[model samples]
Target: MTMPIILPRQEAPVAAIATPVGVGALAVLRISGEGVFDIAQKVFRKKNNPNFRFTASKGFRAHFGTVHDSEGLIDEVVALVFRSPNSFTMEDMVEFTCHGGPVVVQHILKVLLDEGCRLAEPGEFTRRAFLNGRIDLLQAEAIGEMIHARTESAFRTAVTQMQGTLSLRLDAMRELLLRSCALLELELDFSEEDVEFQSRTQLQEELAGLQEELHRLVDSYQHGRLLKEGVATVIAGLPNAGKSTLLNVLLGEERSIVSHMPGTTRDYIEECFLYEKTMFRLTDTAGLREGGEEVEHEGIRRSFKKISEADLLVYLLDISLESYLDEVPLIRDLLERNSNARMIVAANKIDLATGSEERLQKLRAATGCEVCALSAAKGEGLEALKRLMSTMVEGLDKLHEASVLVTSLRHYEALRNASDALANAQELITRQAETELIAFELRSALDYVGEITGKVVSEEIVNLIFEQFCIGK
Candidate 1:
């Protein structure tokens, strides 16, 4: 729960349009830092209450008012008041709710600046919240995630993070690391006296247990990624295997051109499809074949790249064709290339006479994986196919139910580094190495974990994290 040792930042009162810049009913302009209320009062005139002073107003109170500039009579507004140490940045804050027209927002923001408020930088508000210890770096990033979240699942996860659930978990882990690091440092201090602050046996046990926990958190990244950025699913097969057809059906739109001719889809078409709580970034790839034209080759190359990066691979097959089993080798190749991606062999065109249960059994036998039989054209048995798609990412729902998940790649990488450092410390301890060596490794692990929650991080990394956020946030 301790604050990070971040650099001191300016306490200048800053202002910015806190809402999206557009024509809307209302636009909110946020101002935070020292002396914000005084700056706001200069631009805002309380309606029929000239005697009302923002300085005299209670925190969280609002005053109906009109804003003005040197030009005069800028716009009618409602001034929201939040006092120092009780606001977002733990500083005096005020928000002007004015007409949402871009011009009005600009005018109001300009008047505030003219009143001595500096323009807020991108994410400066949230940055202040972090710098002032109102929220951790992880929680700050979570706020950005919540704002940009497209799916309900992603939004829910971000909400949990913003609520400091993950922060609490990381803080617990940090406490453990800090305790061990402190003990090791104590051992180093009394090296001359040969005093052991901690037993090597117990230390090794704790390191092993901590490392295991780190590994567990690291493993959650995949499911956590699925929550944050939908599953990268590629629908792949030989030409005319109904890859595009399946995509069109799943998306309920003719997103890709369907043709009897091969290589009709010379490029990949990507769309987002939400099934239950999980989102599938369905990519219909260019049909795979040997010796296609140069242009097709480039498309094929891109297709393979997408396939390689896929989290879920759906190998669609036109089971009605005599050469349908000929696709078996292609499916096997895809499985080999994308071994990390969960796969489903979709036996398409089951409405055709030859599309039979026995053919699906043969596919299952050849691929050593279950086959989903369906007709993308007729849209038959697609519910089962959709269910199979969900099954490929099984445990996703349960993962969503879990409180803690490492959705951010930044967090995952930090955890991985921490785990590596802990492993090194384990080796050093087992080797009966000098206390200083073990302590160094433990500190490295400690800092790595601290980076996630902003306990120990550089100014550059802090800037980089906030840079991704929009100005208002």
Candidate 2:
């Protein structure tokens, strides 16, 4: 057995509001530590009693009050107290429900700050919740995810994580690992007696199962990241395809300049939309057309560059035009360049077209991409387009269930490295290499899994994780 690593000890006071700072009905300010209530009482005042003893209050009880400074009353507020070990941070926590004006919130926070509390860093509140044993690292991350989730489906997955679904699954895997480690340690103890703690077949089976589970989790990162972040979609087509109008209708706002002139949009425009619980960043780029002005031609060049990075390409066709000359060749060339990118052939301006079903059929038959007939100007057939986009992004549910989707690039890289090490170790095992080499591979694989939940992480890695968070998470 290896000696456990001793982590650095750094305890500090932290305070921040649990709600957004705005002119609303109320804002919740949370302070957690050994002496949070006493700090609150120093500045808090009740109408009937000039002095209120905040620390003496029973747990979870609310106290009506007006917060004050030396000059005058700052704002009317209600305070809720939670005692140690029973609170979110397992420390004495005080919550202030004050009027939600920015000035009022700042003043209240100032009071706490003056009383020796430090400004909470982004995710500090949840970090404390994690350190205090109320939740694990996964749940801590889930809290942040739930706070920022854009769509209902994304929110639901975060909620599932918060409910311990992910933690429970990880815990099961950890248990198996712990058992295997214990059995390996026992082999060292009984090696002189030539007694087997676990048979070779049993060890192989256990390793295979553990490897399978790790790969599944590593795979889930793909779907998880898609749900967490969003898909980048690029809109490409000839000028006057109503791509701008399509972008506006999908976003429910006129975020882009809409004009009938060809090459009106000379730069890429971006907007975000949610469809079927998934988020998508829609990039409306300059129309791909020949013989444009130099500036417009440069814009078209950048549009193709953006198309290369896109997860999906939406090819718009203006059916009202006399002929779709530019698109047929442009799309064929794009497909040749990016064979893996999902492409959708959308026949725009369907409402204005003159019996364009034949044109739509011709376009669809030529490209062999997913096709949708719609009018971006009239908001026609948009729901169908949205549904198709969701399907393309999520893929078939059956595939997701059958294989693990790697969501985070961090997790994916780690898994790939771990898999490589495992394969090396397996080859060495077949060659009857020394026990130390096999053990090294096992430990390396374990450390890779730990990176996902931040176990045994370095200070630099922790800093990287926290840096990704917003200031007031």
Candidate 3:
């Protein structure tokens, strides 16, 4: 790995609330830097030990004390000490645990500031951890992901990444690429001697192997995206087909307005639904029909846009009417246009429809996809629909068990670029290209992989990544 980034920051000791900013039973304020213990000693007085001093305190030791300043005592607190090279930032740090209240916390913070502690910036503490060699860049990003995770799957994936599962794999890849580049460079330096450190055919085999592995990592991005962000599932059909009702049933809330009049829902509504471990971003789109008002036309345009981008399309049909069967051709058109998207046919209003089973059979035979019969209004057949939805994305659970998965778009793009460079190197090897040419390609690939783990990254890119975090992280 390359050396840690050296970004310019203020030299003063930094302090910020370690917990969420709200009234709670307790709150923690952390400060870290050189002379941090000295600063803590200025405002803290040990409860029983009158001679207790932070500078003389051992690491990981906690002292019951009252934090007082020029104005007097702010609050009674527990001061936990972490000596240099042991804390989160790998610096001398102290965390003050006090009663959680806006006013109380603010008073303590003001006292710390008055005693010479600068407020911490957004993500500054984690950035210090990275600069001080406590965690890598990927792990830093994973920490942010863990904080903002919305689903259980997302949380688990983030936790795995933060624990170094993905970093270890990328580091191994870097070693292999670096080894090949060194060999190729040595060959270039001794061109006149006609010396070969390794045979060209053997080098080609190594490059081909790396290329295959890179391809696997690049291809896994799609599955990783589904884990990081929920699947985009769109609900679509003609007006008055109980689309709104189905959306409400799936969400277990009356989120959309149900109506009998066609074109009542001229816009789209979206919500999240979690089945098993998978999350679905369910969107109830405006009904598709022939042209109507200008506003309706725009809504239809947007509905098609959503359908085109969906991972799962639920085409609802009112099986009560024989005319519903006539909509098959439209379904075929949608499938044709979006052949990449998985589809399911939902025959609705079975409670009031005659010969519903026969209609469902016909629909099943016609659509060539998963078909389910349900009465959205009465909330029947919901279990089957949910089970089918879960089965639609069946293999994601296996991905969770894999050693490493790429869930960040930045990582995905970098992997793709690195894989493409390796591909080029492979072709050059097959044709017995110059050693310098191969070495250059190998070096490029190495750098790209390093960028993902912050081994060879720019300060601007680093700032952009850490800026996404909230303050006190």
Q: What is the C-alpha lDDT profile of model 1 across 216-328, one tens digit per residue?
A: 78888877888878899999888888899999999999999999999999979999999887788999999988898999999999999999999889888888887777877
Q: What C-alpha lDDT values do all the predictions have? A: 0.87, 0.75, 0.87
Off by over 4 Å in 2: 1-10, 46-52, 178-198, 258-267, 276-278, 289-311, 320-326, 336-341, 350-355, 390-398, 402-417, 468-473
For model 2, residues 285-389, the per-residue Cα lDDT tens digits are 998878988999899989988888787889898877777644677788888777657899898888888878888778878778888999888888999999998
lDDT of 3: 0.87
lDDT of 1: 0.87
Ranking by TM-score: 3, 1, 2
TM-score per candidate, chains pooled: 0.90, 0.83, 0.90
| TM-score of predicted structure 3 | 0.90
Q: Least accurate stretch of 10 residues (summed lDDT) in model 3?
A: 395-404
**RMSD value for candidate 1:** 3.5
What is the number of residue pairs that collide in model 1? 0
Residue-wise lDDT of candidate 3 within 1-473, one digit each (tens)? 89985533324699998899889999999998878898999999999888988888899999998999887888999999998777888888999999999889998899888889899899988888887768899999999999988888789889999999889989999999998889878888899998889788888888778888787788777777788778889999998999999999999999999989888777889898888878999999989999789999998999999999888899998989879779999999999878868888998989989978788888888878789989999999999998988888775445434556788999999999998888888888888788888888889999999999999999998898889988778
- Model 2 residue-pair collision total: 9
**TM-score of model number 2:** 0.83
Q: Top TM-score: which candidate number?
A: 3
